[model samples]
Target: MAGGGRLLRKAFPEHWSFLLGEIALYSLVLLILTGVWLTFFFAPEMSEVVYQGRYVPLRGIRMSRAFDSTLHISFDVRGGLLVRQMHHWAALVFVAAIGVHMLRIFFTGAFRRPRELNWVIGVTLLVIAMSEGFAGYSLPDDLLSGTGLRIAQGIMLSLPVVGTYVSMFVFGAQFPGEDIVPRLYAMHILLLPGLLIALVTVHLMLVFQLKHTQWRGPGRSNRNVVGKPLFPQFMASSTGLSFMVFGVTALLGGLAQINPVWVYGPYRPDEVSTGSQPDWYVGFLEGALRLVPPWETNVAGHTLMWNVLLPAVVLPGLLFTVLYVYPFAEQRLTGEWGGEQHLCDRPRDRPVRTGLGVAGTVFYAVLLLAGGNDIMAYSFRISLNALTWIFRIALVVAPVVAFLITRWLCRALAEAEQKRLTRGQESGEVRQTVEGGYASDHRPVTRFRPGAPRRPIGPGEHTGTASQEPSAPTRRRR
Candidate 1:
């Protein structure tokens, strides 16, 4: 019972950036809540049925029962559309929060030392989150989701030897088989969400087990944490944050429209929608699929779609592999293995790492932009092929340029910080010496705790006034 009281008194560092993880946690809570509400009205079966909903356009149309129930949720159930939108928006925010949170962790080197396993868990959670999102969207069995699923099917079928087997295993037969919707619903509602919750629980336990990494500053060190207690301070703030997150998501769900399945019509094997793109998280894969040049290899009468396999399979595989390996890799590369890193490094202090992170971000951004090449080409009246070629070139070139620029910027920033610490801040007062030379007084910046109180004139802060300056340059000086 000695440590029982410590549980309620756990300290959490107070920084705006730290809220990213909290936002992700709150978003997950919203997802689970709204998702549970949805399960009551949603029918995840893929059996063929006639749509008899109030939506006039598709009233008499033939559609799957899954799509029909989605329509029912949208029209028949009270506040169903609102809950659905909130759920969708919450999912989007959840993915985004996790992304920025991970970025903050990576750039600050919070993933090092004892936190390496936590970093891996975070990466796995991201992968599962994306998979969960994919499954969630596909469950409605609408045309847009069907197209995404079709792309997924193609990606699977693009593999050389086991492609067919994989596709069959997934769809329970071939693409657009009868069993796909039910299977997707199960994964979306049951399997993926369970994994997410379990991984998140473990991530939190590890975070609590180890000391939090904070910015290096005065009164901050590896052994001690500086922040509020968990009992009232953090818990109160976190509770308010949860409501805010829920309210904002609910507002977006009610006021803003998303994934209007009825408008898109039901899934059909023969049809495709123009200018359709997957959600933003999935955009990079779509872009990669669009940008890669067509190349196929046939070995022993088996055709291999390198174009699909490379971007969709190999690229994402490598990206996630890098994520899982990065903390250990950095520790090894920096010759800091087996050393704990409790103080988070400012991005400017770690130029190589900052540059690499920027480079990877640029690479992802290029692929995301490429994902919508068709839409861009159409909207701007540009040639699709030309845009694709441009993206292909940029995809290879942009990351290198970003890396060089980021490294230079980091170095420049580091140099600037050194100068700042060396010379201190200008105190806005000009002082004249007996020799008639005037110089500005510089105040040494004693503390560097960002987001902390700056008033009350703390130690090392310049409190000198004009009245305290040497009067008449000490007229009696020899």
Candidate 2:
């Protein structure tokens, strides 16, 4: 059994590219362990209860059991606050690692052929992770989370026909309702988690079956992997990372307090904070909302849900869908089919693919910045409408420019490579030759033909049949 375990461990790849997925897996494990601990004390119910927790400052306040329990965990339960904070922090890390990992795959052109479906699955996992975080954050029914939900509902209601139905189904009624909290709780704990787990399982299976992409270098074929095994090295590194995550969570819990529902108070209809924001993962959606023009109209007695909802829901859905289908779309465009690629350190090695990835990243960043439009406007003292228009135009124009620039850059590099192959490398300095001509003291150029006569030539010398003497004469002399 020990020998069998050793063999299995030896089969696992230990490349750094493989670590991105491991980081995500470790974060998920931390989330689950912390979540299980918190579940014992948390009350998912939204029924109003008088707050009488261990915190003397906010004693006897009127709040829901969820809020009161949160208070207890924050102040009373042994290391409860730290555990809670760790879970939240780990969640953030999990989402971030997955995003970066997907970017790495995209830039490396690893999302080709056999791994296209895995790419789709990865995008789905991201969507589910975002949903889970949103739901979990909102379960306390705090002012901040409530405001976010309201924005979300508006986005949902912006769809042309089924907006109202979707909104109603999601919220369990309009605005502040009793069922919303419990519904979010169920999704946060059960639905999203299940889906995420299943998708992750499938993703891992695909990864093992297809194998990880190793770095591209001399003698490194795409099928040949290079790295440590999963047993001692990878396992040790992952364990350390898990501990690091826990430590960071604890530090954040002790030093910085986020989502202090006690401070925000209960969810009231009239109250609004100046900078109420959703979690970082969903910030891009918020940015889109700020950038969209507030236009409204009525068609056939049904209100056009454009002003409030379109940016929030439809746009984000479309964006994620595009990400999911991008690999297949790219394959169709390029007509290049392959299995997993060997990893490459230089982004320019695969120019078009890398450029496309960069363009997509820039597009996402633009939207994310747009999400913070109000903050940007306030800081810069610019008209919000003007800011919105600028971003809206950029939303269309920036991506096109990025795509063109990236493609141009790629073509330029390819041209440079061709030139290098034909003309040879240039030395930095020019030297005067003894034969009254300028010469470069650069390394001699080496030609790579499978099997051919090798004769050294000066610059500008003919290298084909003109340069070679008749071999038949030499054979006759021999």
Best candidate (score: TM-score): 1
Clashing pairs in 2: 155-309, 287-370, 287-371
* Candidate 2, 74-174: lDDT as tens digits: 78899988888878888898999899998888877777767788999999899889889988988877778778878777777778789789888887877
Clashes of each: 1, 3
lDDT of 1 by residue, 309-419 (tens): 999999999999999998878777878976577878778878899999999999999999999888899899999999999999999999999999999999987677667
- Over 4 Å off in model 2, which ranges? 1-15, 54-60, 338-346, 414-431, 435-440, 444-478
Clashes of 1: 1
Q: What TM-score goes with each of the models?
A: 0.91, 0.84
lDDT agreement with native, every candidate:
0.86, 0.74
Q: What overall lDDT, based on C-alpha atoms, would model 1 receive against the true structure?
A: 0.86
lDDT of 1 at 432: 100
